[model samples]
Target: MRVLIVDDEPLARARMDALLKECADVDVVGSVGDGEAALAAISEKQPDLLLLDINMPGLDGKALAARLAHRTRPQVVFCTAYEAHAVHAFELGAADYLLKPVRVERLRDALRRVRQRLESQPREPVGWLHARVRGEPIRIALDDVICLVAEEKYVVAHRAGDQLLLDDSLRQLEETYPEHLIRLHRNCLVPANRLVGLKTLADGRVLARLAGTDFSPEVSRRNLPTLRKLLRVG
Candidate 1:
């Protein structure tokens, strides 16, 4: 398991690092003194878990966890001196909370739970897709797809300057390649990274604009909040 330690105290960071050296199957990716630095480390290292401190000068641990609520990676475990924030930490879906002056045994227990949680979670499917473009069978790289839309019995995959017909349904695509595609409507699945913006037309219909293509799919009202979260805008 990859871990990132975030705390304001230098001694606490060193102690945690020392204890982690004794633990098995663990890698310390990086250590940061504040939440802002933690965020940067998270983006860079993409650790599997975080050993976070609750109180700090800016962007405290709990607030940092809240900021990462929309994301699915890098689970959090609170390591704090105060016991008062236990309930709130758990409420934020923390894997575990350890008190200051942490023991090696307790740290190992937290790591065990995190490993179990990670193992039980379903992994997203990757690789290529076999589809047809103008009756020509070609394997499309999943990363090159901008969007997939369900039309009658076929699903159409849109790339930069091409469109291919697929046999799989939108729901199947959404479930199979969750890391690649996000649902904008019942009929539309757009790659999270490919999605760039949302445009409101004169008819008051919101459409999702994707990168590498001009095809804008209609966004449903039921999925508006999800779209906003994906775009990180309201």
Candidate 2:
């Protein structure tokens, strides 16, 4: 497992590193003093687990965990001096919490739990969709995608804050994420969760408006009735 240690104390960091060396499977990719640096290290190394400290000058460990709510980049096992924060740590979904002046045997127990958790949790079967942008390959997560629109030979993937143009087709996306995406039009397939309801125009045409977004995709005549029933809008 790739490991990153975050602690403000030098001796504590060194002690933790020594103990981790006993675990032959773990690799200490990087160690940092603060949560800000830890965030950067996680983004760069993409570690499997983090040995985080609770109390710090800028960003505390709990706050850091909250900031990471969007994506579970790395599993966390907080190594702190305080015992009072145990409930709060587990509430944040920490795999384990170890008290300061950690013993070798206790640390081993935490590592075992982490390994078990990783082994038990099933990973998503479908991986990312690779698209080249600005001469570099950019992989977009299927869950982050909002919609896919067919444009001639290319498909335009609309995401939360960005877009990706793909050489693939809309039919390919439908086949891959059939349960998550619904065909809105002949050329458009939007995420099922994003489709809030159908908006009927004065001319009797309808458009599917997305939740938390301003843009609405046109609802095809064939798909209009099914979408209305799905959204429970008569």
Candidate 3:
């Protein structure tokens, strides 16, 4: 399990880092001193777990967790001195809570729970898709993807500067992430949030445009009604 440690105290973070070496399965990806840094790490590293301290100067653990409500969140384990925050910690969907001066045995148990979750959950529980393109392995976070265009036998994921051809089918991808990607045509699926608006021509032709890009695909007649309903257009 990739673990990130977050705490304002240098000594506490160091102690947790040293003890984590006891578990061969756990790799310490990185440690951050405050919640702001932790958020940045969350975007860059995408760790599977976070050993978080509830109390901090700014953007405390609770606030940080709240900020991550939309994105895929790592399993959180609260490690703090105060016991009063236990209820709030659990309310924030923490996997476990360990008191300060953490014991080796308790840490082991917390890791065990993490292992169980990792086993039961899907590999890309965060909507990330793995694909091989140009003879190189690429990890595509769904957020980075702008759209999926179906080719003859593969689905090409279009991004800002790059594109990825996936071996998987568009049907399965749509079924897996219906909330994020919307089908505009039989061969095209676009990021729901990036879709700016639909434009209709004098001849009753419709095109869907996305933000930050001038590229627009012709909207199919079959999906026009649904797309219009989504955009609140008549």
Candidate 3 per-residue C-alpha lDDT over 1-234 given as tens digits, one digit per residue, 9 for 90 to 100: 899999999999999999999877888999998876785566457688999998997668877665444443478889999999999887877788999899989999998987787677655634786688777877788866778899888788887777888867888888888877889989999866556567898999999866545678889999988887765421
Error of 2 at 46 (Å): 0.7
**Ranking of models by lDDT:** 1, 3, 2
**Which residue window of length 10 is worst by lDDT in model 1?**
121-130
Residue-level lDDT of model 1, residues 130-157, one tens digit each, is 7986778878767567788888889988
TM-score of each: 0.56, 0.57, 0.58
Model 1 off-target regions past 4 Å? 122-234
Model 2: lDDT of residue 90: 90
Question: What's the count of clashing pairs in each model shown?
Answer: 0, 0, 0
**Cα lDDT of model 3 overall?**
0.80
Model 2, range 1-234, lDDT digits (tens) per residue?
889999989899999999999876899999998876776566457677899999986657887765454344477899998999999889888989999899888988998888787777643423477687986887876655667888888888887567789756888878877766789999999866456556789998888876445678888999887787755421
Identify the runs in model 2 with alpha carbons over 4 angstroms from their true place. Answer: 69-73, 122-130, 133-234
Candidate of highest lDDT: 1
Instruction: Evaluate residue 22 in candidate 1 and report its C-alpha lDDT on the 0 to 100 scale.
Output: 91
How much RMSD separates candidate 2 from the native structure? 10.9
Global lDDT of each model? 0.81, 0.77, 0.80
Task: Evaluate residue 158 in candidate 3 and report its C-alpha lDDT on the 0 to 100 scale.
Answer: 83
